[model samples]
Target: MKTAADKLSPTRVKLTVEVPFDELKPAVEAATKKIADQVQIPGFRKGHVPTRLVEQRFGRPAIMQEAVNDALPDLYQKAATEAEIKPVGRPEVEITEVPGLDGKDEGDLIFTVEQDVRPEIDLPDFSALEVEVEEPTVDDDAVQVRLDQLRERFGTLVGVDRPAEDGDFVSLDMTATIEDEEIESVEGVSYRIGEGNMLEGLDEALLGLSAGETTTFTSKLAGGEREGEEASVKVTAQSVKVRELPEADDEFAEMASEFDTLDELKADLKEKAEADAKGNRVALARNALLEKLLDDLEIPVPDGLVQEEIDNHLRNEGKEPGDSHGEEIREDTVKAIRAQFLLDEINATREVSVEQSDLMGYLQQLSAQYGIEPNQFLQMLAQSGQLEQIFAEVQRSKALDVVLADVTVKNESGDVLDLELGGSEDDADADDASDDAADEAETKPAAKKADESGAAEQETAEDVKAAAKTPAKKTTTRKAPAKKAPAKKTTATKAPAKKADAADEKDAKESGEKDA
Candidate 1:
């Protein structure tokens, strides 16, 4: 047993397990005695039958079967201990050598265990880690959009005598038929003209009918068992109504409640819109910051996980990930895998984790997005086989939040970005990162060129790698980097302007989005 472990690696090992024949002897004796008692012999009483006679009748196979069964469990335990393997699931045991009573009296048990080992990780300087997050800010434009939506909600529809038009509210009686056979009909249904919220073609059919007027039309139902099922609608419009937008004056405002004038409403709407926008940007930044922190990670993502991610992407893209999405899928999967790995590493290091309550909280937020109750939404997720996925997502999010607490966040301009929970800073970073890398590449051609290498380029590539790993600056705090000034300072010397600055001035002559 001592020598067995010496041959195996510390991380994983296999052992040649043996159960001595001496250990099997007692079990064999007990079995033979039991058999002798059960069987009747002509010369001896059934209980008094000799062991040798029982052995002769049953032979070695029966004795060995009993011995093997008795010894297997203890043998397996001894072997696993000897190998020092933390068996995750189960072992596939094979009897390598079976003990025989004669020359081949003793047999050895051998088996192999394949399992995932807890990886030994190399920790970096956690305190030195820095990340950037865009802060949430309420903007005027965002508020305006919200206000417009609100205004639309407050507007009322009143009847008009002209041919029914868009945004009109019409009260009508309707009937459906195909080939002069009446299939379905209804009366006095209040349908919004040009708002196709219900059955197909009904709104458009109602647009032309006025009070006391009727129009007949036929069209197919969009999606139904009766798809391609044609229906004729006879609409008698009891009323035709258009939006009666309230007057922008103070008296109408007083009628609407809470506001003195339309301007005040618009301002409030603008503020809300801006707040929403800022909140959106902040949320995006938080997510982006988390993703970037994960970007620095190096780990082998399991093929099963990547394949799963690819399949999901393909399903969402509404096409097979094979061939077309293969490359894209691989790239995305690797990034996703890295992100998850980094978050896991952080979780392990800091002991931060998502609990069941965190998962419930996450579900509540998701439910809010769809305007559904949390429990109903949870049931939907459970029924759809998505509970685990949702749980994982929640964990990832919680992990990111913890990461934000631990990391230093700054912007490209070197200004410290504010952190917001559940923000969308990632999209901004994605855009800005590309721009930064592109700009960096434009200035650092030698570095980029050195990265493209074959045998001849190996030495230079190594040099580039060496340089990249070394920290050039200690930029732990948020501060916008200014154009580097020349060392020889004059009494009133201007700074050496950046090449990008020149391009910017050139762009200013053209439109904001025009080519530099």
Candidate 2:
């Protein structure tokens, strides 16, 4: 077989291949034998039919077609190997020249294969890239806040007749109609005001409503409403309930948790929050390290990868992906492919490998989540023929994790710490300050007017603290500070006077000695 390759573009390649007639003999013979076995010939068995008779009946053109069909796989493989093309999809093969049976007995069978190949990648250094991320800081206040949430989780909801406050639960009845015909009406739906589980407006809509008041609103149905249609929802407040929080004392701590004292419980919460914060910091740092590893990466995405992904998506949905989504998915597919390449390079550099034990453990965890035994899940997977795919996914995840593990992790403090992403030391304080400031500014306009007043107050506080250690000022004049004034004058007088006395004493002794 003779072959030549042409580089069409970064993502596409063309291979022109030629196979001589003599090299195609085995394939031709096999096809003829296969046809002979299929056709019925008088006085001969199905398997024992003669090749000459079969060829004479079926004709040589049919035989040549069969031969080409049989030889395509081997020929394509050889051509790809020779051209060094990592073909991404099934090639569009065009036969340029076909063998003529009698007139030109032996000639080259030329074919042109056009297909997309894997894009070449030029990766950048990991150490050169840097990204600024908010560091994790989980302080004592955050721990206490989280502890409060945990305590509330154990507390029972009590119904009361009062205006809906921040920590109140409201019970309501709602009717959803598609076309003014009520589809479903839910009653006694107990929901927290800001949980956001229900439709977007429902929570905010329920916030101010009293126990006996009714409110009507429209919400878009989950499934597309009748092509450009919206649902009319009527919500009625059945009852307004408030959370009766237990006291935040030692007694409350003993009742709510295993801890004996409030301080101990608070300490425990702080520890938990700190641990979570550390873990988050490590995760962030790991990502940063990966970004650093992939500083100037440039890679051609494997052609057809995105389309293949879209096709796979459609396949899962039991439909073939149309050409409409081809261009749009390319952008996303390129991003995904780049990420994969970075991860792959990192894995290779670090020699990251996944263990079978880890995969089994992950599967067991998944099994537990789904409330099935590990073996039962495995059996189901085997029946579905997705067991290998699951393993491949596991391998890929473990490989990524290995890279993440080897990367650097540190908190915003630059203290070589591993902390959780959102959990931070000053988070509660920042939240509290922001909330109080905003609330005060809104409810009492005087505070917003008093921002300058607040800055002035802060300035006065600084002046008072500064003046505390310094000596008192002189009342005589508005001159420089008088505390250093006397010291300067005294040192000046004593030095000159001592020098004059020493000179006078030396002169007197010399005169008396000369007179003697």
Candidate 3:
């Protein structure tokens, strides 16, 4: 066998391959046997027919076609490996010639494959790259917010006689109808007035509605058979309730936390808040550095692959292929593709690798986000053939960290910031906590939250400790962090809350829930 490659463009290649008749013999035999098993011949049992007789009955050309089709995938893979071309998306293949098609097995198998590939990238000197981020700071207001969040965890929901307001919890009975024909209904569902996770305009309609008051709104059904269809939704407030938080005193502190005094709890919250601010600064700096590289670099992206991604995105959103939103996302899609190509090249150059611990840690973080068991999440990744993709993502993140380490980052005040990208003491502690949590999860069944509106109220001190210890979501080239200066950082160099592909994450969560 032999292979040759022609450079069609910086990000595209065409490979031509030739194989001898002997290489096609095994596929030919297999194809003959397959046909024999399907055809009925007199005086011969199924699958016991002679190859020559099967060929005569099915025609030589049909046998040759089946053989070629059976062999193309492996042949193309071998040819691509030999040519050292890293194909990105699916390849367009054309079989130019096939051996044994003319009643003679003398000619060679010949074919050409056109494919998009990772482009060659020349990385700039990292030491020369510089970026500025806001100075890390923790104010009283921020600490108070954290304190309030913790307090909410122990708050009691008390029934109220007044109208529902923002931050109030409500028990609701909702029914959807089309032209007075009831389509769907749910009774006694607990919802927070301001969460906005329910139907659109629900918060607005519920506001100022007292217990037993009913209001009607027009909105599209988000799910069920009539999803996306506009309908009249009638909602009655069964009950209105307010969460009464415990006092921020020494006695309350002892009940809600490990600390015995309110001062001690506030101090710990302040320290965590400070760490969060520092993480935010590092995230900002990392984004600035990445943006600089993207702006200065010119990596060619394959138009065909871009279009395919755009079409997939639109299809996932249940929109037409030619939707105008495709155009809106085109710019982001191109940037994401370019960033992946860039980081991938860096990953190769720097010889970045994902260790077992790193992969496990990532899986644990993702599973926690989706509220599933870590082992179950790992199984889902393996079953979906996404383990490799996740590994690549981790490698890309580490590669970016390498680049960040060499770059100079400063705050707005022009002071050199000691940005701890990773491997910090806090990170190590978080990892330990996560590992412990995972072990506990494996040993015991997970406690499900009673209600989304009362999530904070259900959490214990241990949960709060784990929450404070965990870092921000790790980002990758595909899921670049927004280029905004955060009020407080969630991770040292992690991306914001959104995952790389929201749709994929949703699907994984749904599948994991079903499996559970």
Candidate 4:
């Protein structure tokens, strides 16, 4: 077998392959046997008939057709591997020649395959890059704010002699009636004034109401039989209370914190605030570095891949195929795909290995972030065929961590900040970042499933192997990235109060979608 590759474009390739007829003999024999078993022949047992006899009865055309059908996939795979092409979507195959149909000397089998391929990325020495992060500093006001929060937690609520106001806690009796019929009622419920945690307009109704005062307001019921229905709610303020914060002194500090004095507590709070600020600064610096890297590159993206991603994105969002901001989405998706590819290249160059422990750790983090049992989340990933994507994401993240470690990071004040790539105090919430990566996977464009044309059939063995190992998806976080990019810092988002399993039924169906 021999293969030749022609560059159709920066992101596409065409491979011409030739195979000797001898190499296809096994396939032809298999095809002949398959046909023999399905047909009835006098004086011969099923599936035991000689190949020549079957071919003589059925003619070589049918056998050749079946043989070619059975052989094309393996042949295509061989050609792709020999040519070293990373096919994205399916390939277009055309059988240009097949000799020996006339029972003469067997000649060569020839075919041409064209498909979109993963573009080659030229990665620079990312370790040499420099980025400026914000200096993590805790101002007195920030410390005071944290101190105030601590004080509020230890504060006592006292019965107030006046009407309720914002920040006041009120004990009230409430009854809901819809169309002259009572819906629900509660007695002695305590609510903080202006919290708006319950039905809308409840706070306004309670405003300026003295003890034993009654007020009626119309609002929609939040839940129950009359949910979303307008109801007249009558409320009677049973009592109003105000929060009284303890003074910031030694006694108060001793009661509220582990410190012996207010000054000690304030210093501790300031240190914590500074640490938090440092985390934030690291995230900003990482993002800035990635954004700069992406801005620096001129990577060419496949249009078909970009469009496919756009369509998938809009579809996932429950919008039409060509919704608004499609161009922006396309651009973003393209950048994301490029970033993954580039990082993958870097990961390979660095010879990064993802250990089993690393994968388990990543999944555990995701399990916590999604608020599901570890076994359950692992099952979901396996069921969806997303375990490979997750593994690739973890590898890519670690690769970025490597580059971040090598890069020089300075704060805005021109002071060098110590940034260890992994295991920094800021990484305590790295599991939160794993959630972001998973979410990004859920919304990743189908670059691997891009539209294809000009190929009669498609198969790429190398692609199958690579995909089985490294499926395409958003693998890392980025503020924005350029040609030669760096890692993005991790920022935590509030995990949903409800576990992901609550929506498992809805997600389970599409969990195995090719692109997240």
Candidate lDDT (C-alpha), each: 0.47, 0.52, 0.65, 0.64
Q: Which order, best to worst by TM-score? A: 3, 4, 2, 1
- Cα RMSD for candidates in order: 21.4, 33.2, 14.0, 12.3
Task: Give the winner by lDDT: 1 or 2.
Answer: 2
Clashing pairs in 3: none
Question: Tens digits of per-residue lDDT for model 2 on 161-245?
Answer: 7666554666678877887788656776666677554554776677778887888888654322231236687888777765545
**Over 4 Å off in model 1, which ranges?**
1-109, 113-123, 133-137, 155-282, 308-328, 353-361, 368-373, 382-389, 418-516
What's the lDDT of the predicted structure labeled candidate 1? Answer: 0.47
Residues 1-516 of candidate 1 have per-residue lDDT tens digits of: 221533233223344555667766676677677677788989999788887777788776666555555444555565555655433212333344455644355653232222221223354564477665554555655555555444444566566768887766666666667778776655655555554545656666766666888888776643323433667767688777665554456665455548888778667666655655554554555556655555554454444334544544443323555747546546644554444455555555664454665566555654543335579777766654445444444444555565565456676677865554334334333333233222222221111111110000111111211111111231111112232211110000111111212222322333212210
Tell how far residue 230 is off in model 1, in angstroms. 21
User: Best candidate per lDDT, number?
Assistant: 3
Candidate 2 local lDDT, residue 62: 70
Candidate 3 residue-pair clash tally: 0
- Candidate 2: segments with Cα more than 4 A from true spot: 20-23, 98-109, 123-134, 158-258, 292-295, 302-304, 307-331, 348-350, 356-516
Could you tell me how far off, in angstroms, the CA of residue 393 lies in candidate 4 after the best superposition?
1.3
